[model samples]
Target chain A: MDRGGRMTAVVPTRATAPASGVRAAARIVAAPDGRGGTALPVLDGAGPLALRRTRAVAPGTAQVTVVGAMSAPLGGDHLSLDTRVRTGARLAVGSAAATVSLPGRCGRSATYDVRLTVDSDAELCWLPEPLIAAAGSDLAMTTRVDLAEGARLVLREELVLGRAGERPGRLVSRLTVRLDGRALLDQGLALGPGAPGWSGPAVLDRYRAVGQLLVVEPRFRDRPCQVAVLPSDPAEGEAMLTPLAGPAALVTALAEDALMVRRLLDAGRQAAAAAAG
Target chain B: MTITTTAPANRAALLVLADGRFPAGGHAHSGGAEAAVAAGRLYDATSLEAFCRGRLDTAGLVAAALAAAAAAGVDPLLLDEAADARTPSPALRATARKLGRQMMRAARACWPSPVLDALAAARPRGAHQPVVLGVTASAAGLGPLDAAHAAAYEAVSGPATAAVRLLSLDPFDATAVLARLAPDLDRVAQQAVDSARLALDSDVDALPAASAPLLEIAAERHAAWPVRLFAS
Candidate 1:
């Protein structure tokens, strides 16, 4: 199929050939259409990146769901997702399924870079499915968000070390969130192989699933969010909500499974939104 | 640190600055050991060593890098912001600043440098402890490596000492944990200096941002505890 001048196969095969891996960039741009709804001006997807406009529940929010057309981000593949939420607009980007990284013949690591931008008076909800790092696969994922003044953001990041009954490959994830030219949160977490002491008492401590929720609300400029320990659901492990130095608050949680982590983080998002209002 | 302040960097200065009894307000904090103990994650010497090892590599690496950057002559204000960007827990951030303020007082009195005084003036509430430690190291005529070593050592030593008190484990076992971690501390300090050198040439964003989420969550939980032996 011809996707924006690039010849990409509509349905990718499962041959797992390292040489045939495609490097692609997906783009999504959302803006208000002046009719009390949001518009998607640029929704281009190629290769394994399949971007589809989903039904957004909010009044003026546009939702885009990423559907992987192929079993990728295998080793040696380079993928990028670039998104922009224009002024007075809202965007929620999610994924259809969990992305599982696999080892390819190339024996090199894969890279996934996601860049999100929100303009003044705009909002972005970036909640994607968990990323599972399979055994023998190495991937480096980076997500950077740039928020203009008066912009609000709700971002969720979750990582599962490996599938059940298997060891995990090395996965390094870097998250940098900036608001109005100032940094809100910047953290690099390395798990599985190559990261010594990650599963020790002070770190994961036998927990395999980890996630966090970051809420950047301009309302926090006046009265800051109070730091509190999030009450854990009986199934979950531990979580906390702490106000950032900037106009943001973060909820960090660790659990035995991805479902529990997401539950804790979703509860955190509600608390943040309710507090902001 | 020495008889004269004009002399070359005194080795004892690092000893004094990094001393557990330096009155830097670190004694009240457990570096997450208290929470780990309360959670039963750390109840013995072996588990305590493992916990300290994790802290040394994640939080320890970041702290050492920030301190090294400061001691390398990077702007303290800029480093302070970088520290904030790396620290996600409000309780942890507050503890760092409070410790920074106390360290500032001690550093200004001991080293008496204009840089220390200026940083203290800029951050009245106080800067991050690592950044202040870097500046204090520079004031004492030490270098970035020295600052990194001090910070890295403190990362393990604080938890070890606290584990001794909290777990009531043998004191010698605690010191042995630190001794076994000496080689790891050296390696982390070296890596921190390299990162600091890179940041000095480029920007503070180049510093390490390694994070341990359990530590952050535990710290916040400990902060909210109705009654606790440790402040954080």
Candidate 2:
């Protein structure tokens, strides 16, 4: 599953998940082949996870889907993913469905980590489905992205604390993005009843769901990006938007439900598109 | 924790740095209290105490760690990047830099150190506020633990002072809230200094990254408020 100019030894042994849940890992590396085709130098998956590439929707762009067991991961489960877009290549990654995380036995938490890299002049758009943390669940996730000069990236993340009428679980999420070896955005949050900031008005404001969108590129930095506020009831939600250093912008929203959070993300996406153009 | 240093530590410098009237541009900002008041989540002394305690442990702890690292003579540029990574809200980042610039202006006039001048010349726009605080403390002959105390105190004091104005709550109550949290603040400062000592040996990334999402989100929302009393 490992390929390219440099040949690295691949560990063929796979770790199996327990009957309660699954521990999975995957890595995808895309490069431009001299033969005019997109070269997948690395495509590997373990446990119940699978990686699939769909037909390209545009020139130089390839779509990737994450296929996995539909059941929620059990407590103490770990999911890891790594992706790389080589020079001159474009990649769009999406998930087949939402990930539901269940509580681990004996108070153990599940974790997910994703590491992404984009070479110079490469583009990446990762729009994954919302993550639902079931009641009594404890989950932690971290995503780190490294971008070379001239790289373009659009990333979105959505989180729902729990299903309707259920109390939310604990969640700790972190995102670190860098451009040309300089930090662009570094953000981390701990939510749910156990976190100290969970009840603060400035954190979740008692909202059940939250979403964030980050757009980074040289073209979007100087341009003003405005986030549209949906005229919802005061008790429903609120949205915030700001431009960061190094041609980046972030839009965050908190809402009473998942659909409203999605709507907020759409507004941000539109604004990002407008800024990029 | 053993701190290997050549210079004697100035204990009195902590009081000067932690003073509310430090002219560091902190008076204009409420530490997200303005937005909380607008949202009706804060009203009386009870909720204010809760809010201050939360800020003390999360954002306050992180800031103290960063400041301690800076005072410990760790690279300022690296600490600045770590600050940027720990802070997620763009508006909050801008505010930190703005405050950092103001602090630099005051620190240069008070301490008059070559390091301060070099940092100002390099980051003309300003570095993160905690980073500047740490460097300023170092230049003042203060130890990393002293810087942590100042940072941890400021974290709760800023919000407590703001609540008095934003809610028209009794000034005595706000002051009392901070007084009650003195022991917890000491613990947080100690923890921050410990973490900073570890960071000096390993990576700056080892510093605490505790965050308040609503504080960041509210700062962004507050930035767009056309008629707000506070700057952030």
* Candidate whose DockQ is highest: 1
Candidate 2: tens digits of C-alpha lDDT, residues B72-188 = 988898888888867767778888899999999999988989989988988899998988999999898888888888899989888889999988999999999999999988889
Per-residue C-alpha lDDT of model 1 across residues B124-197, encoded as one tens digit per residue: 99999999999999899888888999999999999999999998999999999999999999999989988888
| DockQ of candidate 1 against the true complex | 0.76
| Cα lDDT, all candidates | 0.86, 0.79
Predicted candidate 2 versus true structure: per-residue lDDT over A144-181, tens digit per residue = 89999889898988888876677888888888888998
Cα RMSD, model 2: 6.4
Expressed as tens digits, the lDDT of each residue in A1-277 for candidate 1 is 1111211222223564447456889999999989988999999997778999998878789999899888878888899999999998899998887787777676888999999999999999998888878788899999989999999899999888876666887899999887887767899888898887899988898888889899988889897777777887524577878888888988888888777788788878778777888
Going through the candidates in order, what is chain B's TM-score? 0.95, 0.95
In candidate 1, which residue ranges exceed 4 Å CA deviation? A1-13, A233-235, B1-9
TM-score, candidate number 1: 0.93
The 10 consecutive residues of candidate 1 chain B with the worst lDDT sum are B1-10
Candidate 1, number of clashes: 0
